[model samples]
Target: MNAKILETENVTVSFEKLSRRASELKNCFYCGASLPAISGEHIFNSSWGGSYKDKNLICCQCNFSFSNSTDKAFIIYVQAVMNSWVFKGQRHQEVPKIVLENEYFLDQGAKLKLKQPLIEDEILPDESIKSRLTFNSKSEAKRWIEGDGMATWLGRLPLAEEQEKLKKIIIETQLDRTDAKPQPISYQLNLREQYRSTAHTILKCLGFFLPEWVQGDLTKPIREFARYDKGDWRTFAIETKELFPVAEEATRILGLGVHHNSVEVYWNSSTKIVVGVLTILNRLKRSVVIAQDYSGLDSILYVVEGTHGSKKPPISVFTEFAQKQFSLPLLSVQYFSSPNNIYQYFHDELQVLMGIYYPIDAMTARLIQKIEKNNKKNLKLDQVSLEEYLNLFLSFFLDLAKVASTSVDMTKARSKLIEYGFANLAHQHVGKLYTDPDVESLMTLAFERTVKDFHAEVLNAG
Candidate 1:
């Protein structure tokens, strides 16, 4: 029998650590044999009624094929992952759960389908939480192109080895990684296709877990999944099928080749274009960076057009901010050369930024020097004394400043600032509506005073 493709919708999962006292807790919950992570048993069994809720943990070697012949519990388990569930109490405290689903087609060559849902919504800020999804195929041809047939990837964790490997594959695929290009990914797809014959083998698997902060809101929620890609920083795109909306997004990520952890791919409904980021963090060991971006849509810095010169932010301005505010130290708040300098900055001093994020390190100091150099070029001013450079840099060039290449109405600017995380520091200040535009002067003063205050806060926080 060929494995069928199955979709898991807004599946909710969690994990718990079992004490590793072999002599104390080695018995399987089902039969009391030695435990290895857990004993394997079908999530659903007809004899136990139709629900995954009644799963009985059995030892891995002891699960003697409780075939579909007698259990309906696995059937219920499959359905729950796709549908939102409302549970009470410390839900994660319950035993780790698994959602079992498989395409049971009789034809050996028949293709099976599987999909994992994500989220999206209109009117919310760009970085707001929205559901998303993915549709994968298990047939040879499609699997060759798509990578992995009825085989699936787990995003969240606390699973046994095999499940962890799948999770790592997904993470590697999603981040901006070294093998971010198409060739590596295509090669991997070919490899997974070679295993199409085993796609429906019904191996044991584990469900995913949510981050500590987010409670279980499978419907409209936020989550943290383990992810990474080799940072050799490569990126790619995919076309979207008409079935889902928000399929066209401008975001970019790294593709860390075949085996590294990668996150689920993104779909954009707006333009029918999808972009995925990948990176090979360590080419030496061939490791990848996963869960690299948490600011959501911050992956794409979208500044309203024509706002920068007007003292408002240009789209390019926001991209830099996205990189700074969300990217980890190695990736964010760095002084990458001149042209790139324009990508990220805050309205406050780097020292202030250092405070919010922690203290400034030597790398950041070099970055500050880089930004000052770049800013000098932008102003078209002649070479000045080091003191002048220091004053200008100290006054306006914030390590995490909101750089505007244009001007906008106070309301819109404030909204954009807050949405982009500047809310952590800066506030919107309204100017006299009828006065001649003195936006730069206004910005300079606001930036200076605000930066001073920010530095003080950082000192206090520290």
Candidate 2:
């Protein structure tokens, strides 16, 4: 069967007063071509569980082209997170295949399977051949035995007499289970393409929610960077030091059985810059420079729950329900200016992305159960014991991938870890198996070592 391509749905409702004005997207937002008789363009990739779209913002040519280029890159980049979340988009066929080190596949329900089937035959001293077989599924084992075992093992086709003997051996073989090791995954992200796609997302959202600014001259820089790769992609959606605004509120909303997708367009009057932030599956957070010297809407928060069977309209803070629930914050007036500082921001983003496999609740439950067991034994769980338990917990559950390779600066990552109360404590408890050093340097060094061991290289598309 063919795998399902990610897809989204068209949305017609608008937010606040923007709903009153007619849409001005007569031409494609990216190529300026006449609108095609195709489905709307998704603001967020459907692979990231986005359901909302705008029918008039982009033509079929631009839409199909992007679906094959930068858009596809963005989807592939986040496949690990999407699969870990068990998030099925509007048309997801099955969980994506997340292979680690080219040997194991991460299956649904937090399980792992060997990609290659294993078969072993050993001749005993008594001249008897002891055979063993392993496969990811029973069907695979059955196919191999019935289709190829006769030629491979016996060196001849299994006739009526030999077939009975082979069948008897297969029926008598006992079943066993396979265990998987916790190894670091090696993966790459083309930052150039990812940022370009993120910038594209912001622009698409602007066309859908704020049609008044869709064709403004001030939007030229962003449009060129997103569509034609005209400028430095880094400058368009620069990484900031903080999480996207109102992230806490968004997390709460996501916990209620929905994957969150949102686009925040805010005008920072102090800096005179209009910034756009896109959050997908509440995992990827990107901020982009939409326009400079702006004079438009002060703030527009567009949120949609992206999942199957969701028919609710998009949410805006201007609505009474949203105003009471979400307290939107102003976008940052500035981002880190230095390259070293910028690289640290990306490292932090990688850490957040890794949270997709961090089973916090399950780990918490295990820790609690351990403590309770110790209590029943009348042995107090001391700090040392707790720390050792945590080390094991992190080692067992956190599915890590080295996303960056170039050495920039660990100073900022160190400081951020300390700021989050992870300095001395975390260094003593976590990452001991990988870095075996202090937490400050361990944070960066371990990630580099993990990737190096797997022979993975992450590079910029430029």
Candidate 3:
């Protein structure tokens, strides 16, 4: 089944056209203010390489407010991950100061007091002592490097009393990283606020695609909920209990294909639920999903489906009737990309997995039974050749490994596969896939095969 690949040129063209249309929108979608003056609002923050912006959709005041409040929180939440990735081809200028035993480890243990801009030669390959040689006072310099390699200080501590005072100030200002040994650095995150920020971003993006009619009525409510109103927006931005395996696979695929953040919106008409997903920096961090109840808002759903020539892809939409029965809408939007075949494969696999484990409600049991019956009809085992079965099995395991890696430490990902029940499938045919002797070898093989298969799928689909 040959599929039309969305080329980079095509994506850029489509996105630019969309941006132009969005810019023509007259009112601030969040505040309903007249856009007499507007500012370019990036769907994702520019710090993370998001360049797409709409020039006229948002009022300057709304844009500034979001930037200062919710957007600031979002940036803080992902700053650590962004720094680790060195996003936008630049290293972070300022990071959380790391202090060890009252001594600062500036720039990842560089031990340099930066007084001026870094020149080309300062970015050295080897670890060498590079001093800026400027100080506010001799006493400040003495206190800063009391025990370091460059602490010679011309053989004397001239301002002993002042240096002691500076040392005491360091003790008060610095965070002690020395005592927290053998443990990973932890950041205190306000989960509720982060989720709220996620909700606001999702709604803000939705404002772009939604029709003016739907936007006219819903924008005010969405704006209030996303901005000022403290009503339970948590329902829209609930976190998954377990990490999504498909998110890991999609992140990998997207990283290789698109160099920008991707947004996907999904709506279920029966349930009146709209789900928005935002993937940042190609999934170096977790993907955020926001689901909103729009059951009575069929017009909005219709508008989204018809807007921007948004055609449905050639795949089945995984809907859970169970949620509707329970008066709960369960819509999920995932932001990831894959080659056509791999995309479809993961889509089908995730549907089955979700139907099995993360069922929407009690009615999901019935939905699962129906899905299994339909699968039996659609997938003919007897017509499947031995080689095809092996390829499919290998792809499944590889995807599982990829997902496991994202959920936990990479070193322990293989073991986690076994603990998470992936070993059972492999054990039946390929022996213990994650056992000690074969674990390392199998893990390497799985990752290699996954990449190889992904390329093959891309080629075949194209």
Best-fitting candidate, scored by lDDT? 2
Better of 1 and 3 by TM-score: 3
Give all TM-scores, in the order shown: 0.15, 0.61, 0.44
**Candidate 3 local Cα displacement, residue 262, angstroms:** 2.9
Report the lDDT tens digits of candidate 1 across residue range 323-350.
2222212121111233233223211222
Better model by lDDT: candidate 1 vs candidate 3? 3
* Cα RMSD for predicted model 1: 29.2
TM-score computed on alpha carbons, candidate 2: 0.61
TM accuracy, model 3: 0.44
Clashing pairs in 2: none
TM-score of 1: 0.15
How many clashes does the backbone of model 2 have? 0
Better of 1 and 2 by TM-score: 2
Off by over 4 Å in 3: 1-20, 36-38, 88-186, 211-219, 240-259, 284-462
Candidate 2 — what's its lDDT? 0.56
Which predicted model would earn the best TM-score? 2
